[model samples]
Target: MKSMRAMNVSQPRRIRIANGQGFWGDSVDAPVRLVEEGPLDYLTLDYLAEVTMSILQKQKRRDPARGYATDFVQLIDRILPSLRTKGIKVVANAGGVNPSACRQALVEVAEEHQARGLKIGTVTGDDILDRLEELIASGVGFENMDDGRPITDVLDRIVSANVYIDSFAIAEALARGADIVISGRTTDPGLVLSPLIAEYGWKQDQWSLLAAGTVGGHVVECGAQCTGGNFSRWWEVDGWDRLGYPVLEFAENGEFIVTKHDGTGGLVSVDTVSEQLLYEMGNPKAYLTPDCVVDFTSIQLAQDGKDRVRVSGIRGGEATGTFKVSIAYLEGYKATGQLTVSGPDAVAKAKVCADALWGRLERAGFTYEKTITELVGLDSCHGQIPGPPPDVHEVVLRVGVKDGDRAKVDRFGKELAPLVTSGPPGITGFAGGRPKATEVLGYWPSLIPKDRIVTHVDVEEVQ
Candidate 1:
């Protein structure tokens, strides 16, 4: 458990890190476009979130070889030639709950494309699903971070639990000559930070440098966000059809310029970069990660050129002794159904339809833990902030219910179709059959001692 700074070594003068994929379901062509359009030292992709782990677990339960993000393999197949020619390495957390399977799939794709010399690395030990019970038995309280509830509250229904690891293991894989690194549940910034560590031999104790690298990663982690893809001033952005992905021109001293490939469409200015810096931000002074505690307030941004922003002045502190764990468990069942009501007094009719449906369900002894009724064309999003509802031509009536009892939620689904013929005169748009009850997975955020978890890296050549 040496400090990251303690293992540091010297590296090149500069490195270019580009991020193509933001989340699990981002644009599939973005990764290929990133490799084809530019020169980069590394391409990072982030593909996991809290709810994503549950979905992947269910997929793995149904089929052994299906849990990881299959899109990564398809993208690799499309970009293998460019990757070899450009010598651009890939670092991604597309492993979801199964890094080994993800690495094997990548290896298979490389071999299929005759990319014989490609080396793939797998980082495991983030998953703690099978170890939850053992840890709890060993006096690991595993209490919920928000509610302080113990792990035993939903132990029987838990599906997946993974620790948010850092960049060390990923760096280790790259140090062993891995061309691609597949990891399970590493912190989003770690995917980008690990390359800095692997290439520059950055020591673990170099808090300020690690912090600056993390700030760079956070800015571009969402791919095009800092490049004006999700900017508030959308009209200022050019080329709506092909927004450019992000590229970080990182220096050995931890100063980097955030930009995109040449001739690409997107605005990379101080405003755009500042907007992404506030995304998912908690305390500006103490943005915690497994590698270091980065102080967002210390960051400085400036427009370097037409589509580049220079990011500097980042400061960081030593790392904490614990790791945040994301755990998901079965909460209940939920179903939602919607009907469009048209013509004059549509709002009134929609409200009437919703009441009728709920009345029928309640009369039949079906009580839901939670219920919601929304007028889609009106106050669904703004609520009372929109003020008095306007006289609209049509409003979609959406009703949803959630409960631990599956049968109750299912019964609520069946009650929606009857409203078309029996309850409302202007009701229509119910062609998709009855709304099916789906399992509602609840998220449990917790923390665990760093010593309790162990992470390792394995590298294999495509044969």
Candidate 2:
């Protein structure tokens, strides 16, 4: 197979990019099915989330070889033969907090499958955990974008800090002949857009084209979301048992068609695509990304077929000189405990059980920064907005508390088990043991100048 650089430079009329996995825990079979089911130019998988990076950091701290998403390695092994035979290159941000470790694992997998001559490229330098002190000393405030609080307040408790990188390094890897590109902390859309940029040779200053690619990426970033998995009118969707992930047939001019495999179940319509476009979106007029500032409001969507949607007319502005940073720090500790309350008047009994638990905590001179009590089967989701709760057969009593004192949170966990035996006649479901206090990691969003960071791309053959 020729490298992406040696591919036809005239640009194909359309390129199909498929998203196999959405988040870290998405179905492992999705990628395998994506490669085996139909035609694809690139298979992009997104595995990193703000909390996921922190979890990976904790794993790396415990075992140096275990930080990256291990599922990605397993998935690659499952699809290695198909990927090689079909000449389908892969781009993924499954490295989480450690791209080097992820690349090493892929090398081992390639060798295991006897898939010689496989080039794995890794993009690193997004992680800035060790440089936080130096950056702060250099006047990078690292303030919380939402609250405007300096990171110095929680510097001592920081576990992981990674800047959201763009697609330039990923494109560089593909151009350098990497069959699989692994990136740490790259933006989700960048995983999809990188392949487009590499194949089309889109210039760095192509704001509108970059924005159009970003829009296309955002539509399919969540895997099956744009394919009717989370659609509002889910009843209209077909083949619920075997829903297919999304595929983007992107044109050189930035127009794209959203669809799924030919025989797959799932609906791809204007409504489904629009829902995904509006998801996690802020300021519809100015959607900021590392490569460009996309205007989601200007996008045009149309239902072109039974399960196909065409998206076009996306406009964008020049990108800012800054990159968003995701930082996680230990705020304190929290523990939650739940008990199933059955029999008549279940809701009333559950409320009493919650009050008793907190009362016991207060009696023991324990106070938490926050406390939450909810009836799981009743008003948990809508809170008080749904009016008075309906009378149900049973409800789960859930009590959660967060505090700086771990001992207090631990004490709260002990309160729930006792309630199972002593509080109410119908209380049960405490077989899971006491809910242990866990470190409460808080998210800190900020931005740093793009010039302050440097991304490195390296490709090596698994010979």
Candidate 3:
């Protein structure tokens, strides 16, 4: 408890940032607990994923005010009093696929107490959908990085093409009286960087200083993953229920102190921090971003006593000449069907059943690039003991495939139900409905020259 008490105090004007939640549906209790349990200057909530963008895009197509994160508004309603009372600010990308509606919803929540009229701010003008043609005319071809295809191939087919905007736009929103700042596609590090820029007034191109703070933001962006979620020495982390959420004590000299909530569910040991340090990181030195190229190799983490690791000695230089674009498109159709194979030659029968299904599909003039069949009692995610268990009560065989032909794919879904009554015994169909024929969205990550795109910062008052 002594170590816990040490983290619960104030640092006097130092910006303390606590990431209350990692993604949507992580833990509703976690954010409320972070607010009530600790003294936080700013709370950053990240609720986004590749699939989330697709979901939100669908919502936007239906209603203009329905695309944003409404759950954030409801959660904010519960915490408005606490935030207003403690003078705590908030920055979150729960705007998911829409930032404007998010800001408006927050203003409505603030009207309950009339808390200075709740000056909500939105940072937009980053979206480039309307200007893609102009960008191409200017010789900016956003070639598909994965398939080497040009942007023209799927130009109209593209649903969402957003550049990961930097923190300056968000920081500008904060500087101009935003109680809560909501954004659409700002980078994860930008969430943390915006708070510091707003609080400390750092210049845009102060590369060294900006790089250092960006490093701090990147370190703690993934919630407990940075603290101890995937530590190498998993058994060593104690008291996971109270494992701490990351804390950033910002300094004006381009440095910050990284700690956590006093009594949270994780640990921040050097090993835990290190494990997160390498997760999906490409280059140690010259790590690229929209703002600066940070050098992770230059970072130094000292166990500045229990539960606190002080990081310093980071260096950085010029950013890359281009911005990476995240584009999603229709890939193909995928179907997964599961059934049990048991009785005598259960395993062999399961294989035969799979082959028969494929054979029938082929005879029906349907084809796919790949077909996968796995016996659940044998695969790792579901397998146990590795041997036949008792009487082999059931051996579930899961089958899946991906194909470009939609008609053929639809035919495959119709085949699953028949197998229950026709082929192998005990072939219980989990659900009665046919498998879906939804479009498969694939990520197309590529870069465009920085000179071609102009990122602007705009802030507007709520109605």
Question: For candidate 1, lDDT tens digit of each residue in 1-463?
Answer: 3564454444435699999999989989888888988888999999998899999999988988878998998899899899999999999998988778888788888888998878999999999998987999998998999999988899999989999998899999999999999998999988889999998899999999999989988998888999888899999999867889999999988999999999888889999999999999999999999999999989988888789899989999999999999999999999998999997789888988988988888898888899999999888998867466576899999999999999888888999999899876878999789998999999999999999999988998887
Superposing every Cα of model 1 onto the true structure, what RMSD results?
Answer: 5.1
- Per TM-score, what order, best first? 2, 1, 3
Indicate the TM-score of model 3.
0.88
The digit string of per-residue lDDT tens for model 2 on 1-463 reads 4666556565567898999999988988888999999999899999988989999999999999888999999899899999999999999998888888898889888999998999999999899998998898998889899999978788889999999988899999999999999999998999988998999999989988999889888888889999988899989999987899999999989999999999999999999998999999989999999999998878998888888898889888999999999999999999888999997999889988988888988998888899999999988887777466577999998889999999988888888888877787888888788999999999999999998899999999988
Q: Model 3, 1-463: lDDT tens per residue?
A: 8876666554445788888777776666666777888788888888877667767877888998877777788889888888878888888888767777777777777766566656676776545666778877988778988789888787767777777777888898889878788888778887888888888887877877778878877877788887777787778788787677788777777666777777666777677777777877986887888888898998888877777877778788877777777877777778777776776767777777788888888888877876677877766276466666545556787877777777767778777667777786756645858876667788878887766665555455444
Model number with the top TM-score: 2
Per-candidate total of colliding backbone pairs: 9, 0, 7
By the TM-score metric, which is better: model 2 or model 3?
2
Per-model TM against the reference: 0.95, 0.96, 0.88
lDDT of each: 0.90, 0.91, 0.76
The runs of at least 3 residues in candidate 1 whose Cα sits more than 4 Å from the true structure, single-residue gaps closed, are: 1-12, 386-388
Stretches of candidate 2 off by over 4 Å are 1-12, 386-388
Q: How far does residue 165 in candidate 1 sit from its true spot (Å)?
A: 0.5
For model 2, how big is the CA root-mean-square deviation? Answer: 3.4
Question: What's the distance in Å from true for residue 8, model 2?
Answer: 14
Pairs in clash, predicted candidate 1:
3-204, 4-203, 4-204, 4-205, 5-203, 5-204, 5-205, 8-203, 9-201
